[model samples]
Target: MARVARTCLRSILKIVNSTLGLVGIAMILYGFWMLRVLQRDMESPSFDDFDSTALWFIYTFLSIGVALCLITCLGHISADSSNGICLSCYMVIIFLLLLLETLVAADILLNSDWEKDLPEDPTGRFHDFREFVESNFDFFKWIAMFIILVQGFSILLAMTLRALGPNNGSNYDIDEEYTSATLPLINPHSQTPPYVVGEPRFSIKNDAWNANK
Candidate 1:
């Protein structure tokens, strides 16, 4: 039953890791799309103000996406090879990512008083910012939340599988010491003697004959 549970956990981990890999790819694609959209927006004649903050945000997303994809590959390789070290590293990476995601989510949720601080031009960039805070920001937060949940579950499954240890049976190699130790010892002196016929012989010296001589 324990072995069965381990097997099931391993299978689940594999699926989760594969799904994470796809998520990573999706993140990278989304980052690229965001960059393209930003570039298009920046090329507009009336869009003279270069928002360095927005540019940094896009770059951050791109970097995170790349990191996710790389970590996902590491996870897959570790799982395939059953490498404890690699799995450990992968777990650490996922944990850090989870932490960062949580922080970002919290920051967005906590400092969401942008409406009161809106600039005079409420119909321009300020409006867009408010719209994002209301809609797109929430969307990003939810995505981060999903990623965190998946990563946490993956870590749990990975740890469980690692704890189960290898499934192979006993070693197949011959053990010479054990073989010799188990063998019966032979003692030649312990054998029974052959049956002998009944015979009695006696020898005596006569001292009187020597005296006569």
Candidate 2:
């Protein structure tokens, strides 16, 4: 029963870890797509000069981290110690990546109006810039926030899964634990002091015979 339980647990952990890894990769690619769109729309003359290069680096790192995490999780599920450190490393990377994304999203939302107050670029036309943002604003904001939340939760879950150790594998020493628990109960009075060589002895047999006589 114990062996079966461990096997089931390992399988579940692997599945969940793999799923989250895929999610991380997808988020990175999505961020890249967003950046591509921004690059094309953003002109040097425009007042909207938010740097996205930092975010690109962050997303790229997260993508690589997620790939490594997936491989490590598979190793764990298979009861292999090859990638034991993968999950912990992955969690740290995810937290940093997601936190950065959330901060960028917040900055953009709060400073959207502020950008308009800046001196317009001498070269690029600012025609309908506000309307463009207004049309796609919610879509971008919600997606960014949602991805960050997902990454945060994934990091937490990955850490928990790593701490849980291997659930489905039977390499653990269950027999040792069982024996340790049962050994004390097997002979509770064994530890009590034994009869010494010259201990006091009462002669109840002789006393009973004399009383009868």
Candidate 3:
């Protein structure tokens, strides 16, 4: 039962872990797609009119995607090996990432003027992002919720797997100190006789002071 539970948890963890990588790859492709779309929409496609903020959009998404993919790969390895240290580090990194995402989500939810605080985009690509989000608010909201739930569940699975420890189920382990060649044939304790109390044991005999006595 314990092994089955661990197997189930590990499978779930692997599935969740793979999702992060997929999302990362999607973001990477999305960044390129956004760039292509912007160029296509322009009357005169050129980099001269490209804004630093627009470039930032591409780089930022790509960087995030790479990082997430790396983390996801690590998660898969840790889950497969059931290494305690790897699981611990994975949990901590996931927790920090989750916390950052949560803060961002909360800021978006609570601060309507958040965009005003952002740097201006000369190319006005951020306006497109805002429009996209606003047009599909429900879809984005559900995606955000799903991401949060998966991240939280991943942390939990990491903890559980770490607690379960590695399953060294093979019967190959042996005590190296007691090989067949070094084992004793007789018990060491058997060489010594057990003590008993009796009058003969207490009585002391004396020899006469003669050479042949």
Candidate 4:
């Protein structure tokens, strides 16, 4: 029954790791798409005064995408090898990433006063931007929340698979032999008999008898 559970856990780990790998690939592609958009925006004369902070934010996303791809590869390798060390590291990183994503999603969901800070513009660009963000807020929040949950699930699966191990327990025969070899030998013959402290010796008078004969 335990063996069956381990097998099922391993299968689940493999499937989850593969799915995460695909997600990493998708992130990479999305990052590239964002980069292309950023480039096009930068080439436009109207975007010459684009905020440097926004550009840095785009770079941060790209870095995160690349990091996800690398960690996904680690997870796949760990699953295939049943390497506890790699799985542990993967879990820790995923946990941290999950936390960060959750925080970002929470901030997005809870902060509703940003519109008040927007400067009144005659061009209506800020208004359109605000509308676009408002329209997509729920979608972004839900997606982030979903990803966070998946990451948490992955962490749990990794821990389970790691605990299952790779069937590397010591062989019974080998352990028996090792135990036998390490024991000290005892010799019963080497023990000394108890000695008497003082005892009178008696000798038979065989000589006197022979003289008499």
Stretches of candidate 3 off by over 4 Å are 38-54, 171-213
TM-score of 2: 0.40
lDDT of 1 by residue, 1-213 (tens): 765776687777777877677776776786687667667776888667744664654565577667777887787776665567877888888888778767755775687763454334411443454477667777866875676778999898778767766554223224555555555445445565786665433212345566677
lDDT of 3 by residue, 37-154 (tens): 7677675645356545556656777899898999999999999989999999999999999989988878988998888777666565667877999999999989978988888999
C-alpha lDDT of residue 100 in model 4 = 79
lDDT of each: 0.67, 0.56, 0.81, 0.68
Which runs of model 2 end up more than 4 angstroms from their true locations? 1-84, 113-136, 139-142, 167-169, 172-213
lDDT (Cα, tens digit) per residue for candidate 2, span 60-83: 545665664564454344333323
| TM-score result, candidate 3 | 0.73
> C-alpha displacement of 20 in model 2, angstroms?
6.6
Full-model lDDT, candidate 1: 0.67
Best model per lDDT: 3
RMSD per model, one decimal: 11.0, 13.8, 9.9, 11.3
Q: Report the C-alpha displacement of residue 121, candidate 2, in angstroms.
A: 12
Ranking by lDDT: 3, 4, 1, 2
